[model samples]
Target: MPKEIKNHICEEETFTGIYSKYSKSLHDFLYYKFGEYLDPNDKMQEAFIKLWENCKKVPPSSARAFLFKVAGNMMLNDIKHRKVVLRYIQTKPKEYTNESPEFIMEEAQFFDKYQKALSKLPEEQRITFLLSKADKKPHKEIAEMLGVTRRVVDSRVYNASLKLKAELEEFNKFYAKKPSKLL
Candidate 1:
């Protein structure tokens, strides 16, 4: 426990002190968990606001955990909303484009294969790969975020790469047999 935790968070100076103490760590946690799609700052601010609103209910010693719990719940809600939106988007018809049908079809096929391969990966591996490759986060940071050892992150990424490589190779071979102008 830090000295800030001893202060009553309802007081203006104490509240500001608490915010200064935990805001950056909380924001980083949310960002690492949610990735680039969602804004962590908004969620972090909302968590602090909730804390201020419920100041009377939370005790000094437990404020940190309380804040994290509130933020985590908010993030879960956001994830659920995003899933619904994604499903809705997937159901909607695609717009017509000026590109050639062959090019469009090939692109769609490639995307489908890539998605399928990615989906087939184990959840942990997929997450590790995405955090490493898509978010461009380093192994140590990912290790800290995931609460795992750096070696574990490295292993997960290596295994994921191997699986994706094997899957993509098969996809390429299948496409190679087809008579397409794009290839």
Candidate 2:
């Protein structure tokens, strides 16, 4: 075999060996952290691709870290991109409270207003809110997904809740003043 072809074959074997040793744990860790919004299967593939691409520089001892670092950054970038797209694209709004609406018109209006308010939030804060409130992910998991510290995730969740609460309260006040047409 030619020198380059032989070198490539050896590199492929090393990459496969590294993946066999670490892919499962790496995928599990990523799933726990980013499965809510990120695609675990795709991210796993990307990690392997990055590992192979950087195999020459990444020592075997540090391969795990390299895979995680690459995958984590890819997930974060995906989140940021999705956040930007979601800002312009409309989606079904979440009901903050369990209280039933008196009628269809009132229900529709409530959802519309709630969605508008949610759309106004920054993308990062909105993602933090979704992970905590919508997906019920733990702080550490969210922190890992976003490549941030757990404390940062905690603060983001806290602030998001406060903001949502205030917005809902205001919505309630406005809704209360409207005539009871639905009833």
Candidate 3:
């Protein structure tokens, strides 16, 4: 009976006994090696689950090494995955807008107001205006795109531009001369 107890960790009593003896130390080992962010508790519990599933094959004498090795390998895999993601991000070029923070903030604010004013525009007017300004299409091309006469496209775009200029602060000053400022 004593030799069987020494040889097998599959028995319920021996498994629970080993769990109590080693669970805390195993948790501490993982915690110290990987910080709380990586979830040491999860790794520890996973290691124990693997141990439980293989209890019949593993002896009590080798349990500690088995648990630590499994947990360490899992942690290493997670770290390697993080490194791959970081490498991907590093390979991407950063957007290099030379504008100052204040300029960028003011531009955002203007964009918000412009979006609001544009949304308030009548649908046909908004569509025509966008085709003209955003697509840089001429009035004749915008008319062709909208399946409307050139005069209709011209009126819609003109009315939409007037409403935008009125609703947006500093828009006329900045936009009138090729947008030298507030781009």
Candidate 4:
């Protein structure tokens, strides 16, 4: 019988009660949904703060849904922002004064090929591989986030690795026959 619940608006007591009841579940849900890309605890806290801000509009019964909706929206916004930043980084020119022109060109070509190979992979395999490799997430954690079993995550990573390896090997062979100047 928290005062906030009794009042149907967020009071400090009601907010505390609601937070104690739902914060962990909400955090777990966000983590599972977004993986390592987001900070679940921060998002969870933001959602609760939003709830407190709009307590008059949100009833105790609807608070759970409201919090989740807020958190999900926040996560989506963050993802969108991250995409923009990554795109900017990718397109930005690098200035390396010490490296030879040939070396820089070769490095850029290799990265371009690598990106193409990654893009060509099946979506699920690519995502799992990136999560495991780029984000350094463990198999069990990835499985939980993806709502799949650990074995499935394992299989996806293995398959992705094999495919990427093959693609890179082919690229290397194709470039090997060419003169270094051409590469």
Candidate 5:
């Protein structure tokens, strides 16, 4: 009778043996050839995973070469991806802004607090303030639009300003000290 041939790594024992035999060498090969930055350990594990996935298609004798080839190809693909990323970064458009990150953050906080404070104002005061400042309507125009006297419109705007300024006193002090620091 002829000796039984082991033609594939489909069996768990055969696959595990192949992994035990090749994993370390494959990892070392990748590390030596590509350096540690490319993550040889990860590549080795992924190569093993690929081998397991294709175990029935591979023979135990060829498993070492298969793992090395798969891991090397993975490293090459990673290098290619890095090159594409570098190229994209080189070609990316740059937009310059006069404002610093701190300035932008502070501005956003100021707006948030301003909106909250604005919303908390009396309805008449809020409406008058919005019409005068947001709409750029004068006190006379606001009075006409709201059917109120000019004095009432002025009073509402003045009261609203006082409330908003009082609520935002911290921002005012911060803003007062920012110009010199920014320059």
Candidate 6:
């Protein structure tokens, strides 16, 4: 018998003997390295299972290293799995818009007019305006996401604002000139 095992136990009582002795230190080690990525309890359980499976061959002196290796490998696998899941989520399609018929028709008319007005503006101005207004993306986040300066985003917003004001004024005049509704 190895000296380490002889000092600890004559014959291994049960896996619980191993767990009660070393679970805390092993849990602390896994938690420190992986943090929120994995449950420390689950990792501890898995580590003990590995130790139990190799109990006959394992000397108590080297048991800690064996448990740590098993848990460390599990953490690495979890990180890789999370990356793949995140990529899949990012690539998923956007949801269809749900709205009443009256709302949808109103939106269609507004969008048709808006699209015509947007077409008259410069490309950069239109993109910034649509992203900021229609998509409601914040200027700073948009700047970072698009790899552009905040000043450029501000400039595009200003040009878009001027063009929209002029176009809306013309639209108001056209609507006002039309005959009043019977209702």
* Full-model lDDT for every candidate: 0.83, 0.75, 0.83, 0.84, 0.84, 0.73
Model 6, span 33-123: residue lDDT tens: 8895578779788878777777877767777788889888888888899999999988968676666788667655755675688889988
Better of 4 and 5 by TM-score: 5
Q: For every model shown, what is its TM-score relative to the native structure?
A: 0.46, 0.43, 0.46, 0.47, 0.49, 0.44
In angstroms, the error of model 4 at 155 is 81
Return the TM-score for candidate 1, rounded to 2 decimals.
0.46
Q: What is the Å distance of residue 49 in model 5 from its true position?
A: 0.7
By summed lDDT, the worst window of 10 consecutive residues in model 3 runs over: 174-183
lDDT for model 3, please.
Answer: 0.83
lDDT of each residue in 74-169, candidate 5, tens digit only:
999999999999999899566888889997798778777777998999999999988887777899989999999999999999998899888887
For model 1, how does the per-residue alpha-carbon lDDT over 90-175 read when each residue is reduced to its tens digit? 89676777789997787778768777888999999989988987787999999999999999999999998788778776554544
Where model 2 places Cα greater than 4 Å from the true spot, the runs are 1-10, 90-183
TM-score (C-alpha, index-matched) for candidate 3: 0.46
* Cα lDDT tens digits for candidate 4, 1-183: 585447665577777888999999999999999985689889999999999999988988889999999999999999999999999988957655877899678767876887888899999999998888778799999999999999999999999878877988755554454424322
- State which candidate, 1 or 2, has the greater TM-score: 1
**Candidate 2: count of backbone clashes, pairs at least 3 residues apart or interchain:** 0
* Residue runs of model 1 more than 4 Å from their true location after superposition: 1-6, 92-183
Worst 10 residues of 1 by lDDT: 174-183
Question: Which runs of model 5 end up more than 4 angstroms from their true locations?
Answer: 1-7, 94-183
Q: For candidate 4, what is the TM-score?
A: 0.47
On residues 1-183, what C-alpha lDDT tens digit does candidate 3 reach at each position? 578666678887888888899889988988888878788888988998999999978878889899999998988898999999989988968778777999778777776777788899999999998888877789998888889899999899889889988788678755664342333
